[model samples]
Target: MTRPRLSAVSVLTFSALIILTGCFGPPAPAPTSTSAAPTTTAAPTTSPAARPTGVTSAPAAPLSTAAAPPSSAPASPPPTEEPVPGGLPEQVAPLIIYYVAVEDNGVSGPLIGCGDSLVATTTAPVRFTDQVRPSIEALLANKSRGVGLSGLVNVLYQSNLSYAGGELTGSTITINLTGQFMLGGVCDIPRAKAQLEYTAMAAAGATSAQVFVNGRPIDEVLSLT
Candidate 1:
């Protein structure tokens, strides 16, 4: 039998057809998807309460009291006067007057012509000069005769005479003549006695003489006993 002769080209084409048939023989399987929903998880719950701090409360207020009132200043006192003895004007007057007389005249010798009968003597003559002695003698004579004159003379003499201690209030005068006696021997007893007599006489010459206590005058405060 006469078969068709195959050319080189036909042989190549046949080999190619065999390779394509084998390559396209089978296909791979397709993938599949399911229609399902996604799931969500819930968070933990916390309490809504507030916490306390270190210092919880505040301090309480203090109590109150009433205040005191202010005070006023005090008043000043009045000036004071010197003190004089009271009562028994008669006794004090005579004593004070007599002492004043003795001191003013500088009496040294014994008292004479004073109490009763008015006669006195001394160891020596009066010491004061003639002019001064007579005046002093006059004072003594006047005192022996009257109380008013005696008081006045005492005041006057005391003013002129030097003394240690003395004070005068109203008509009343207190005199300390004891120290005067110490001055004796400087003048003779006669002269001293004469001076004493004269001073007493002068005190007796006053008309307005009075004894007082507490700034008030008293009657008969002085009298010869």
Candidate 2:
């Protein structure tokens, strides 16, 4: 017996069904069984402790072993001497006093010429730097007990005159006096001037002298008196 031939449509339908079954086979091998990418967990993060406000840390300093130098202080000044009370004693030496000389037997005598009447005599020790003043004082004291040595006849002896002071400038010496000046006689004026001037000159070792009595010059007082 002879077999029958299949139609083209029936053959195509059977081929299509066989291809669909091969595409959908075994549920696609169960989707390959992936393990969900292994869930990654980060370690616990810890922060440092907070610091106090306005506080900062500083670096440590290095130490040294060298010694420091010594310093110099200022020196003090010396002490000065203090002045003493009542002053010191004056240096003294013998000084001369001038007087009018007269010719006499014992004590009292007649008037000698005024030009040649001066008699140099010794008195007690007086200050060296202040000889003129003390010499005048000695002359006025009229203590000369020597024979023919008389100053009592002078107007200064009777007038109660006192020595103010004296000054020696260059070769000239000046003698000052303050008191009531009276003239016992007209001749006494020259006698007084001579006595004072000569006495001051000898004491001061001066060549000349100017005598002022009561602020009036010797020459002026003599002219007026």
Candidate 3:
């Protein structure tokens, strides 16, 4: 007995059913367990600290060891002295002056001659250099007293010699005479010169003396040592 042959349609239908079964086999299984998602942590960041406003820093120390300059010092002043005009200092001590004087004899009747120029004299104490003027003034003051020149009158003119002024320069003295200091008439020029010179030199303690008459040098011809 021969078996019956399957139809082509039936065969094709079985093959198609097998392929469809394989393709649609079973659903994929879900992930067994999800690990916690990896945590996303931003790396730690560094930031500068903030300072408050108006903060001040300490001052720095000086680098040098030298001291600060010293403050300037105050200044000082000058000195003074007492005034002494035409004279030595003051009269802390007394000084002496020599004045010519006259001596008399009953016979010669007042000893009038230059040979006795101040041969008879008086002495006095002085206080100032300027006092020299007045001292000489006193010596020649009273011609009638005849002290200044009477001793020399017989030899000299004795013109009532007048004293105008006098001044001293160091060791020198200058005496001025006015009013006919030429002596009325030149009799014994040398003796007249002696009378004045001796008196001034003695009173002033001068090394030398200059005489002026009528504002002019007494004639050099009349110069006395």
Each model's lDDT? 0.34, 0.67, 0.56
What TM-score fits each model? 0.16, 0.51, 0.43
lDDT of 2 by residue, 116-201 (tens): 35555675666655677678887777633342434434446556678998777999998888876566666666667777887788
lDDT tens digits by residue: candidate 1, 65-166 = 656555476646687788886632331122112323333333532343332122222212333322222333333333232234333122223212232222
Q: Name the candidate that leads on lDDT.
A: 2
In model 2, which regions exceed 4 Å deviation?
1-74, 78-89, 103-116, 143-155
Residue pairs with clashing backbones, model 2: none
Sorted on TM-score, best first, the list reads 2, 3, 1
Of candidate 2, the 10-residue stretch with the lowest lDDT total is: 102-111
Clashing pairs in 3: 112-154, 113-151, 113-152, 113-153, 114-152
Q: What global local distance difference test value does model 2 have? A: 0.67
- Alpha carbon lDDT at 24, candidate 3: 96
